[model samples]
Target: MHASAQSQQHPVLDYAISHLTDLIAFDTTSKYSNLAIIEHLRSFFADLGADVSVLPNASGEKANLVARIGPADAPGIVLSGHTDVVPADPKQWQSNPFDMQKRGSRLFGRGTCDMKGFVACAMAAAPVFAEGKLKRPLYFCFSHDEEVGCLGAPAIAKYLASLDVPPELAIIGEPSEMQLINGQKGKIAMEVTVHGDGGHSSFSPQHVNAVEYASRIIAMIGERSKRYEREGPFDQDFSVPHATTLATIINGGVATNITPDACNFIFELRSIDQDAAQTDMQALIADVEAALLPEMQALAPKARIDWEEVFSYPAMGDATGCETFKKIEPILPARGGKVSYGSEGGVFEIYGGIPSVIIGPGSIRQAHKVDEFIEIEQLSQCLTFLDSLDTWMKR
Candidate 1:
């Protein structure tokens, strides 16, 4: 247990803790407007003398903020976090989810752990970053729509790639309980739609049934899941030793009486090995089209099989035997390993050409859950960790 809000005269940490309350107060739920939260942050950064750029999404309902401090001439580090928070169920929470509450050492609120805390820490240090004369630059990249699909980050990453000088490294401040995560699995989300002729259920073999066809696709995915595990290149550290998947969405048939006209299922795969996963996925979809679609088309020439890639997060792996690890590895806990969860680290590693890691306060367990919170002690520890980075960057 620790003291409430601010315990001592650690100005930056205290500011971070207080700022978390303001950040958490905004209902930046993934479904709601993140514009308000992003605007607040924009003002904060501008006041800190940061050179700010706000990139709006297609709808302009959300924005991604890229702020740079220090010498733009040199490659630096990016501190990245998402502005959106997962929706909170009011009935499940003890206190108002938006109102930060302190009980013992923990600060209870939505987005407290899942990542406003990290954003707050970075925001608190804005002045220090702006004032310090440093060898390299520091970029703060805040994105939107991360919980949905890691959608917002790709655009920012693309912009960063276009920069004449991009960051040398990116530290994605995901809740790792202060552990450093050097690698993570890639994710691919696909929506498969099956269309066939509809007829009266009473008349058997008169028309195609979409639900049946959709079931076949589901079965195919299940088979693929098994194959991903039994195959080689397995990493034991991940919860799933190999690629894993499950159908998250399925919709078909208007009523129980009529034959189903169309069916759609959304499925996702988390893969440790990107190349093998992509190859398998391509082959599996081709097989389905070859084996399954032709039969449906013969029955009803209008039948269709469609697969649209909705989202993708590339696999992340730190280059082995690099000085980057030698420099930062000691700052992290000893148990660093891969995880099934995906992050913007992929965008930094694969797109930004910067080695990246996931390290911050809070627990992934508390993220996106009822009564989401971060321990005050964890925040204290995170301040120290940031200070270490500050020292490193200064050196």
Candidate 2:
């Protein structure tokens, strides 16, 4: 059967897909502003009688949208998703990355799987939720800059916390294939800079080599990663089953004939235990300062090793006994696992003090790749999940 014909047969699916297509057309790349999409949603929800609030960044370029669809004075459920997507190259895609394409059972677009599908489904279900007599409120938290170290979700979470009656539970609609995701590793992104004196290659012995020092630190990171894998605090649920760390980007010398004066490398530690990761990172820094820095300084007075934490987010872990967990359990599948990728779910859990779970359509594998797509079946499953949520809220 043709997808369009099938969609027409199911108006709810058709509406959801229509919204998804509209959402994908917006170039809400993390590097650019998401204000355009934010405004569109603001007006769309306003027309639906939702109390919409836009939280703009200091520059007023990007913003987060918080739309409430029920009683004002009570705590309720929050449905959250990020509006920004990773940049996509047109040359790499079969179709325009920003234009949603449907072929067979799949819908292709930049954010189709990574998560605009879930957001669209949430939006499509809004009218149903608004029409119902709800005992509690329902919130749509659409945040920006999530692809870049979760920069926007913290602000949204902070705003929600300040509300007169904060939400009791938050459902972060990440690409979890509709299965409940109870936990994920925390991330700490850092940049390490090694500074040395530039000199001719022939005089390398006299000059401190920044690249050499960078290599030493990279090796140290690898050693620590292995230690964590073999040591305790392992959660078998995760594919890696242990916290991990790795160097992602590195750059050094300008010319082959010159000894590089500066070297910079970016690395990240994804950990199940954030405190342990912090302690280990500090120990690595101390090792460099005590053992490597002095020797480099002996050769060049200005030589130094500096570390900067670029970003960090807490780990999301088991909220099994919380009211939110019990309430959603009946509708959620029995399967639950940990994802390695980071999301705003942690911010909601740790900072907002709201017990949260990650459950939405599609798989993370299809996210942030060429020809990114989500299955039509997945969108239908998400609709069913939202229908269950609506029923739960009515009770």
C-alpha local distance difference test of each model: 0.84, 0.88
TM-score for all predictions?
0.92, 0.96
Q: Which candidate's lDDT is highest? A: 2
lDDT of 2: 0.88
Model 2: per-residue lDDT, tens digit, 1-395? 45676566456998899999999999999989999999989998999999999999999899999999999788898999999999999998999999999888899999999899999999899999999888889999999888888888888889889899999888889999888888888899999999988889999999999999899989988887898888957988875789888999999999999998999999999988766778877887887688788889999998998899999988887776797678668877556688888988889877788887789899999999999999988888888888888898888
lDDT of 1 by residue, 136-224 (tens): 78899999989888879988888888888877778889998887777788999999999988978887487889999999989988888
Q: List ranges where model 1 is wrong by over 4 Å.
A: 4-11
